[model samples]
Target: MLGAGLAHAATPEAYDPWPGLVQDIFKSRPIHDGSGVIAIEMPYRAEDAAIVPVTLRSKLAPDDGRRMLSITIVIDQNPAPMAARFELGPDANVMEISTRVRVNNYTDVHAVAELSDGQLYVAKTYVKASGGCSAPAARNADEARGRLGQMRYRQFKRPGAAGGAREAQIMIGHPNNSGLQMDQITQLYIPAFFVNELRLWQDDSLLLAIEGGISLSEDPNIRFTYASNGAKRFRAEAKDTGGHTFRNEWKIDDPGM
Candidate 1:
């Protein structure tokens, strides 16, 4: 949310936005020793500047026989610092997740994970897209306004009844205006409006939650996996910084069954 009297400035082109970000993270959750248990997956050259996919994973030894506790994703140059955060429940085995995000400029994106034992792990990836914020919205401004807060859900079925796990993808129709883009006709900067949080659920149970920022592209897409034994439905709810919310649901009736 924009604070009073805080004017938006021209975007900057910098390589290392992590120092400040890391400092802030440390201030929030101080950790003494952290190593390389985190991993980031992204392309060196994004084929489409509009929707660059990013995946994050972590590998950690059991901490006192307990699993990792939390993971946070940060995009340095976004108007708001935090991009997404996932909390792992005891039954949660979220080794990886994929999503689309906006890259304001060339910068380093960090994935930091915290284990139950209080140890920190970090991984970094460099994304080359620049000035994505100033890029024109995917659809006409009027059209986007009409479809704001709309969302869609899809579930991918693996072969065979015993295929094991199920994967689902959620897409939201949000302009994600970064406050830096100018109206093609009016030539005035569009006000910033973007998703702030997303929650994924399975049959009334929490699967994962993501916190977003202006760094996420317009109409953001997220993919996550979970085990399905044939009878549970998937649900997702998302909220933007402007306080708007959207929800969607999908049922799983395995065709193979």
Candidate 2:
């Protein structure tokens, strides 16, 4: 029940509705054929366009020694195609990430990965969703403010894996109201309020930082990895469009043991 896509349109001459959007972000570099190494998953038909879930996974060989460095997500044909960018740290085992975004129309979502050596791989998913950017508000402002900035983390360790790192998931509490959603009573488009930025850390060191926008889901959920096998303090800090900041931490006594 996951939808995935690979660009196998015969040649680069294939017409893209938004021609320069991809090249605009990654100038000069050609998007070579990519498969197996990069994977993307999403619902073929999004139930709610405003908060559609998307997951990207990078299959890397432990011997290859090239850790994932960062990921850039582009939603072609959107008002702002550049949806989000994730900058990861050295031990940032961000090989796989799960988050949500707003898909304004039926278009392709590209997940571009930048490996340690600077090579980039791309995976595309064609999603059929619309009106996410102009949908009605799911909740009122007063109710949303009460649960803003709340976050928590959960760690999961796989058995018999390469063991280079362990995986964990973090969920933040925020209405992420895109302001595009209309308030029924007031009949007004609520001002866009969303998580704008995030930084994940292992103790004092920055593990990764993410830039978010209205495209992100109502409550942003992130799954990533970090060096494991011992105790580590995982911290997450985030800021919202409303000028509010959130800080929280998780203590892993003995991870991936």
Candidate 3:
């Protein structure tokens, strides 16, 4: 619930936003500590506020018996606090996810995991970055316009991954402009134009699906590790706020395990 009334004028160190966030985002549901469920990796001080790297790792063992249904990332003080919600494929066995997000202020980034057993687990980490949501796009207008909707996919064989575990990355070219950013030439706010939905598949089965928001940085590259199902094809489909749809497919080469 980054829409309204969550804004605070108090210094980042003096104010707390987690309690209110729990109510608006989770409907007052109980959130347990996620130490045993998941872990969040981020820089203590990001070199660039506009593109801060964050990785979410599942902590459950292979024999844990419970699956991670989905995970939500929240940049508590960002203009749009809820950055993204990723739903994992039941059969993919996704263990890790990495992506970039904008950090508008020095704030606590929370990763809430919803488990198959109907429990919400929360993990927190502090990040020191500012002015991200309103930061100008890295590329010039012309350059950005040229690459709109371009998508790329790559798969990497994990050295010792069991059951054909593999690492893959998907990159989509889009400006992902937040409505808060000002256009240097026009001196007016840029209209929000970003990829709001992304879905990945291995052949006919879902691998992952993401519901995104303005807090996600431009370009939106997502890298993840999953147990490959010996499916011969990988596919991706993305949709933006402007209603443009981008789709791509690639052949999944055998890792020769």
Candidate 4:
């Protein structure tokens, strides 16, 4: 969420946010076209503006020798365009990442990848959505409050995958309020309160970490593909804007089998 405050709404025909976004978010760093190095998958038209699915996939060869350091997701038309930044752990070998986001307007969504070699690559996709940032919470206040800070994790085998490839999902229970929505009863803007930081680890080794902001959907679910490191345990820790920290760990049924 580095460029959170710099975003402004712009129509697809009247403006392009990528150039300014590059300067603001990347400090005018050169952004190479990510035609082959990375790709973004998203719907041209979102059925639900508040929970539009987006996925980032890495196309680097295993022997490429340059690991993906981090990826920044930016939705140009959102009030806070910098949705999330994901830092990949060196040993994780994460190949794919999927998450839900709030799209405030019909805009171009950009994914910028910083590789170990100190170069930045970018890919873009356009989405047709509106009013997502100010959309009402998915759950009512009472129910949302009850599930706050709760977390869940699930692992799945990657079909025809090699090199110990696996897919996993992590979900956190949160309202992730954007502060832009008006309370139906009170008619007041809800203060922005969301899980701003999250980290995942396999035993002592780190897997991934996310710096998030108001542009993400409620509940913040993330599904990713990574290579197993033979670690016996999986752990997650999340911190919200309210300063509450939620931590959990699970023992792997089979370590490196």
Tell me the TM-score of each prediction against the true structure. Answer: 0.81, 0.84, 0.93, 0.93
C-alpha RMSD values across all candidates:
8.4, 6.9, 6.0, 7.0
Please provide, for model 4 over 51-116, each residue's C-alpha lDDT reduced to its tens digit, 9 standing for 90 to 100. 999999999987798889999999999998999999998999999999999999999999999998
lDDT of 2 by residue, 1-257 (tens): 12323445433664575448756888847664446557888898999998888887777766777767888888886776877898877755666778888899988888888876768788888999998877765656676667788888887866665656678888887887776777788787778888889998877777779998777778788887666525468888999877888999988777544
Worst 10 residues of 1 by lDDT: 3-12
| lDDT tens digits by residue: candidate 1, 1-257 | 36533444444554565777777865545543334466788887777755678887655544436466777778777666577777754554566678887676666777888877676677778888776667788889889888888888887775552226566778888898878888989999988898888887777767777777777788888876655534457778889878887888877666223
Q: Pick the candidate with the highest lDDT.
A: 3
Q: Candidates' lDDT values, in order?
A: 0.73, 0.78, 0.93, 0.92
Off by over 4 Å in 2: 1-17
Residue 111 in model 3: shift from native, Å? Answer: 0.3
Better of 2 and 3 by TM-score: 3
Give the residue spans of candidate 3 off by over 4 A. 1-13, 255-257
What is the lDDT, from 0 to 100, of the residue 171 in candidate 3? Answer: 99
Candidate 4's TM-score: 0.93
What is candidate 3's lDDT per residue for 1-257, written digit by digit as tens? Answer: 46444565332666788899999999999999999999999999999999999999999987998999999999999878999999999998999999999999999999999999999999999999999999999999899989999999998868877767889999999999999999999999999999999999999889999999999999999999988787899999999999999999998877343
- Model 3, position 135: C-alpha lDDT score: 95
